[model samples]
Target: MDSSPHKLYHVHGIDSRQFLEHYFSDEPDMAFGDDLLKFPIDSLRQLFTVGHIKGDILIDLSLGCFIHHLYSASEFFKNIIVLKANNRCIMELKRWVDERTGAFYWGHASTFLQEKEGYSDQFGDKEGKVRSAIQHVVKYDPEKENMTDPLVLPPADCVIIATLLDVISKDQDDYIRYLRKFCGLLKPGGHLLLIGCLDTTYFTVGKDKFHVFTYDESFTRKALVREGFIIDYCNVKERTAVSDLVDYKGVIFIAAHKEK
Candidate 1:
């Protein structure tokens, strides 16, 4: 591989299914699956269960079509609106939401959440609840004044963003600009949950290297504080799985509330 900067993920026509298989699949051979998938799910479950983040409407703007974290989110928020940066992600998520043929399997994620919550024989029910809670999944443009045009959304009570800022942002300033935009979507004192990788410069999706802004835990905290967020909870898990697919040092989950 040349020393060229990673190509932008959006421009590369990322394959949503391939991305999931490489990062989120539960197969035994997928070494980084636990770090990329289960870690965030577990962290989100812990944050949602701690009882500080409360809301009726929760908006998710995550990387790709991943919905494993929403299994826990659906339990707390009555209304979930998922915003995707592209139609491919939207369509892929809808395939699962609609339970269409050939949808990617998420039973492992559902089962993990079920076991964590100490529930039995509720995997099917959990999936249904998430599907019902998600009222809409729409494509959005970050540059637009109204990201969700023709469909005005009420200010969200809570917003969850997972590994997306790194993909969309071009620099530190761009990352902070996007944070301000997210803050604008929330009500006063609304909560924000962020999931990201530490010191990661790129990720691979079907042999394509996509750029990811390199950032650290301290930088994330400072960025959040600079964007007028009061950090509430933060957890960072060290990278244990070794993979040549991506060069992430660790994973970080931060829960914060926007300053009123």
Candidate 2:
């Protein structure tokens, strides 16, 4: 629609179930408890499988629906700081966190994660732990020079930025700039967990179309390395499910660290 960057990632006010289901994987083969969560779940598993990724602070710089990976972090980190794209998303997340009425139905994802983590049939316990682990829900403005102005948070031990990178950036330079900004927020030797859509330049939500920066695995790795992140592990999933909204070819997950 307008030329300004779209705030599609707001977690609140949207039909979370329908929206998430559609975006993640709406195909018959990739429905609930299916392929949509595969890469992310596996990526987190890969992260922990190596060794402990525990830290005091874990920041969720992910695109709107962040719960997909939150459970994995909850098991390791003590506190989680989540950044929202807009007030709606902030409010939406708070509703769930506070157990208020009209909150999005996240039980599916909660259960999905529980099953992934070997806590099958313990959805309530998983949900409670996730709720406890998430400490702060901060608002983020991509245009601001100081994105988190008036909020002086401790540098995070880890920053997990997914899907947002493809949408918030208009060019390679912008991606690099954002990466550098995020990297600056981490403690030395801290890690960055990134997930992105490959070869995608646009995505649609209902009737509205949003922009995404198209790139591949090589570009992603080079961008991270150029922005001062060391590669720890990376996995790329070939595009399988077709989407009516975006024409992305694949998804990639990268775990990296910034050396002192």
Candidate 3:
């Protein structure tokens, strides 16, 4: 039950790089099946295309690998702050942002977004936009009851979270508590873009497996409402693969606003 940093790769997708291509590609595969990436990015693509989100300050709650979804935030936000729960995630992000050797290439995903959003056909435009917009990458501990207990961050106009709640929380109450704590960092009426898994008990990165809090759509909506959020947009996709490596009912994407 030890959720140490060393074992976090089991939850953060470091254990499985091959499955990552599917998360960013429009292609189909049977072995690894579908992951939590493509669907959420598609949902975000829709949300950002409509101009529903605009802000100068945006905070990313988790350093989701291949977060080309940042293409959306970079388009509007002047500053982007990524808060990571695990040091490894932060290091990986820095690797790409700094364009270090052996870093996972993100240009393909960014180019896909630029073309999809009709911004630019040239990939570097979107890539530069994101690279320059990213202002900070710091470690964040969700286990801290007071989310800002140690780090004093400015209230953000928008916050983006993915796959953190389900894997981090011990149970429903812990999930709700963390949700409330994170929402407190958002300014009143600020926007929130969240993505989570549904009815999943566990998942594997490579050789290791990690636990997840299984919850349904109803639970997600209620949790948002309980945390004083007004739902704006929501999308849910049924799990396509039930292999031993990955098992889940679905993935949910919600764009909500903190009630003023």
The candidate maximizing TM-score is 1
Residue range 46-84, candidate 1, lDDT tens digits: 888987776799999898999998988888999999999
Error (Å) of candidate 3 at residue 235 is: 1.1
Off by over 4 Å in 1: none
Candidate 1 local lDDT, residue 215: 88
Task: Tell how far residue 18 is off in model 2, in angstroms.
Answer: 6.0
Rate residue 82 of model 3 by lDDT: 85
RMSD of every candidate to native, in Å, equals 1.2, 3.5, 3.9
RMSD of 2: 3.5
In candidate 3, clashing pairs total: 0
Model 3 residue 60 lDDT? 84
lDDT of each: 0.87, 0.75, 0.73
TM-score, every prediction: 0.96, 0.87, 0.85
In candidate 1, position 161 carries an lDDT of 90
What's the C-alpha lDDT at position 83 in model 3? Answer: 78
